[model samples]
Target chain A: DVKVTQSSRYLVKRTGEKVFLECVQDMDHENMFWYRQDPGLGLRLIYFSYDVKMKEKGDIPEGYSVSREKKERFSLILESASTNQTSMYLCASRSGQVRGNYGYTFGSGTRLTVV
Target chain B: AQTVTQSQPEMSVQEAETVTLSCTYDTSENNYYLFWYKQPPSRQMILVIRQEAYKQQNATENRFSVNFQKAAKSFSLKISDSQLGDTAMYFCAFMKHEGKGTYKYIFGTGTRLKVLA
Candidate 1:
């Protein structure tokens, strides 16, 4: 079966430390996304990539950056981790279903804690 | 911009019973998609069901179905014969059909559903 996998299921980082959350999908999907889910705020998008070496900012991109050097792997980098960034970070990928409709397969989320 | 809303933050249902989770959205775009995703205690996001805006017929997937009222801008999920595994946080989402090749998933806060045995 096709899968979206996260390198880590949980992580704890110190404040001011750089953190990396990695996600890889085997479906060869063209779209990959990173979102941070918080209570009451829902899943806010941090960044997304539709092609390798290409990326775009989403609704919430502050304190975060992304790299898509390869098609299967998408990495989220927290340059300087802060307590406010502690939350469940989810990664998802979707292939082209059709012209107008698409669905996503999400990886098991990584719950990040910044102390 | 698209916005999704799940007014009910929490809900409960007895085993083997049926329950519906409510979702509403606001968007100017006439075409779009709506989805119901379940996040279990394991924190794995699973797609429960989906609805296409242009389709008048509500979608059904096994015991999980949807009540899609396009004119009402409401998409609710109904789980029949609720099972213990059905208990999770249900999220509603919206993605507008902008032809500019912009694809984004906008999500609702979520509804926590508990299935009691």
Candidate 2:
């Protein structure tokens, strides 16, 4: 089965701290995405990478940055963690229409808390 | 920009019954894709069903099916014989077809569904 693995399931960070959320996919999918899920706000895209070393900003990209050093890994960085930035972070990966279906395979998600 | 809307914030249905979740989207593009995703308490979002804009027939998967009205830009999901396991948050997503390339999905706020025994 294809799998998307998040490095941490839960994390607590202090204000002004730099937090990193790591995600790795074994499917070798070319497209990887980062989204923050909040109650009543659903999921908002933060950043996505379609190829190695290439990234694009999504709907909500403020206070966030991404790295795609390899095809299998995508990293989301919080430059300065704030209390309001705390939320559930999800990582997803998809292949480029190998079978005409572009469904996303998502990780279990990382719940981060900023204090 | 494409936007998805799920007006029903919370819904409840008895087991063995059917429940429908409403989703509407706004897009001027002639070709696009709509999807329904289920996220249980575990928070693992999974694709339940997908509908292509060009297909006139609605997509179905087992007891899960979609009502795709391209003219109205509405895609609703219907769960037949609702089970306790069906309780979860459902999100409606929209993605425009861009050649063979993949586009980002715009998701709605989601609706919480509860199945009662």
Q: After superposition, how far is residue A7 of candidate 1 from its true place, in Å?
A: 0.7
lDDT of 2 by residue, A16-65 (tens): 99999999999989899999999999999999998899999998999999
i-RMSD of all predictions = 0.6, 0.6
Q: Taking the tens digit of each residue's C-alpha lDDT, what string does model 1 give over A66-106?
A: 99999999999999999999999999998854565477899
Fnat, model 2, is 0.82
Show model 1 residue runs off by greater than 4 Å. Answer: none
Q: In model 2, what is the error at residue B107, expressed in angstroms?
A: 0.3
Q: After superposition, how far is residue A94 of candidate 2 from its true place, in Å?
A: 0.3
Q: How many collisions per candidate?
A: 0, 0
Docking class of 1: high
CAPRI-style quality class for the chain A–B interface of candidate 2: high
Q: Write the per-residue lDDT of candidate 2 for residues B11-90, one digit (tens) a residue.
A: 99999999999999999999788899999999899999999899999999999999999989899999999999999999
The number of clashing residue pairs in model 2 is 0
What's the residue-level lDDT of B94 in candidate 1? 91
